[model samples]
Target: MTRRVSAIYFLPLVLAAGFLCFFLDQKINASAAPAGFENIPGRILGSAGEAVGDTLFLKADAYFHGGETFPNRPPETKEELGREGFVEDERENEKTLPAQPAGDWISRVNHEVRRHGHYHLTKDKQKEMLPFFAAAVKLDPRNVPAILTAAFWLDKSFDRSDAAIEILKQGARDNPEAWEIDAALADIYFYRKKDYARGEFHYADALRKAKSGDLTRFRRIDLTYHLAESLNFEGKRALALEAYREAFSLYDVENQTPLKETIRGKIQSLVVGE
Candidate 1:
């Protein structure tokens, strides 16, 4: 009779244990699902998101630098995709792009790639940096400082002028009013493209806006002089003389001209027969 009673009590206790185990297991699974299920996919998505986010932020910050929100993406790519296939350009584009927090996405991308690339460059690790720098420049073309920095460290960096030109062209499109962009374009045309007329046009375009009354006051020295040089090279002695004269006049205003006398001397040699 005693043995039978022990068995009855022990059976209930065993059943209770099993129930407790089941309850605990269910709770653990519920808690683990969030982190466990999303562990790998979340990381991948996060990385892709960060890459895209940073690129958008950089471009936004570059153009709308007043701490304004980033602009929406351009429509050219949308149209291109539409032409490629049956992908329609609608509000549904957001379906593919993840939502973003507020900020300059392009600038953020520049900072990210620059940070990673700079570190690698310092360690003399070109293999580690070239691909990253290429991607950075490709995505954040307006970030010329980043490109310049990486180019300074890379071997035969001048070879990347094509890359710089591509970015600058985009910058020109986005920031048409910026004289510096015009000047940069001129530099590329003159120095890299060997197209003096186009290059001269860029410098002249910059000069139209360069109200700075001094050579030192101008944004860059090379642009100021090169345009003059191009004039002389293009057989426009009259215009070249005028440019040098204006350059000197600008220097006279600030007492900080860039070798005005040399430029004046050049004018004499060209105009009056040295």
Candidate 2:
């Protein structure tokens, strides 16, 4: 009888332990399940956003080029056309061929109804292209090409250097590791804004990042040369000479004769100036 009572006590303890373990396991799984499921929706939305961004970029590119065609040739200068034996009439044809404006279905229908069989010149195509690039960046903030191209047009075509600088600053924040952003910043500061100090700062940073990344030797040489120029413009003759010498060292003496000569000229000029 005593042994039977002991057995009954041990059975209740075993049942309680098993129930506790089951409850803890359910709690653990309940906590983890929500986290896993939450990521699924986020991943889906991110992919959809990237796809929409791509579509907007394509539309913007079509507008920028004024058509949908492979290998869009840039508008030729008069000198280039003359060299190519193109007469004035042929040179006129070198301008962007007019095309229907790219837009949503409703917009396309409206355009067709309002101006059927009539072509309009895309003289303000760059301005019209800005909205799409802006929307693309809103959808996908990581769109580097859209950011860079928009900045280029703003600064070069629109004479909006401040706006371009702002956009590039945002891009640099979003993509800290992108050496191209720093390079663009350097160019704008050096050439457009005439802030040689800021230009030197960015160029040095860009060169460091490029060396750490996969930038080609030729490109690195270009960056170093520009860095030297920025330093020279800032009147830091000693540092400029050192940077120029570094640029010269980057050239392959036998194979890159012209490049070596160019860098050597820069180094010698700086040395003579000092």
Candidate 3:
């Protein structure tokens, strides 16, 4: 059986959906929003206008400000950034968070709604909130959480898997090195599209592109282990074994002997035709 990875590893779409619900309530029922909530996009736009010549900085800023003002800069894709060897500032590396200003907006809104005892949202309300997330992605192609959470809700909540896949594909192209987007695409292919081969391919790509410094050791192990699972799903037993071995090597157990032994047992099972 395929190991069902915890939703904790998946994008936190429940919290994301809650955030979107708060925003949707504010947009639909103006009284639900703070006094200047409507002006946020405009404020973000005005700030973007001041960042004209610095395309990279603008992209980074747009990522921080919800991307409402700027058009998608095609030439400045993350792939291009990788090609240009654009290293993020050490300060940026220190601030570890999946960057998404619109999602931040949603988070703040959701928190206020919950504080006021008005957090529950209907299905209809969730449906109404979809467009806002889509628009956020349109504004900022690098909005990882916006793309992920929007796609998650669109597919799971709205039965719009095709739309979700399209969003993820675009996100993959835009953020070429983003293993999270690739992993999500792999999952969508396996579960939603039922394309095991494509799923395996993406999982492999995610594993190949993953850098040890960028991703946590456990996350790296998970990626490799899941790649093995994908290969197994595709009936590539040998590749699966190799992946399991890779996963085992990636794990830095130290005092975590139980997990180390568990992975060892997994490797043994694969080797002995389990």
Best model number under TM-score: 2
For model 1, residues 1-274, the per-residue Cα lDDT tens digits are 3545588788999999999999986776575323333244333344463365355445333322222223333222444444432233343221232223337898667545531100002232333445545555444444455444344334244466666665556556644555666677687778776888888888988777655653345454456677887787787888888787776665645464448668878878977752
Identify the runs in model 3 with alpha carbons over 4 angstroms from their true place: 1-115, 118-120, 253-266
Question: Model 2: per-residue lDDT, tens digit, 1-274?
Answer: 3545587788999999999999986776675322234244323455587678777887787665444322334344556445433223333244362355576898678656642221222445458888887767656556788778888878887899998898788778767877888899899998899999999999998987765456888888888988998998888999999998998887776755676787788888877887
CA lDDT of every candidate: 0.55, 0.72, 0.64
Model 1 clash tally, residue pairs = 14
List model 3 lDDT by residue over 1-274, tens digit each: 7898788965687789889988985675564222245445423454352233134333334443234223321223344334422332222212232232345778867645532210223455456555566556555566677678778878888889899989888878768888788888887888888887888888888877877677887777777777777787788888888988988887665646665676688779878995
TM agreement with the true structure for every prediction: 0.46, 0.63, 0.54
Clashes of each: 14, 0, 0
Checking candidate 3 for backbone clashes, the offending pairs are: none
Kindly give the stretch of ten consecutive residues in candidate 1 with the minimal lDDT sum: 115-124
Q: In what order do the candidates fall by lDDT, top score first?
A: 2, 3, 1
- Give the TM-score (vs. native) of candidate 3: 0.54
Segments in model 2 whose C-alpha atoms lie over 4 Å from true places: 1-47, 67-123, 211-213, 255-262
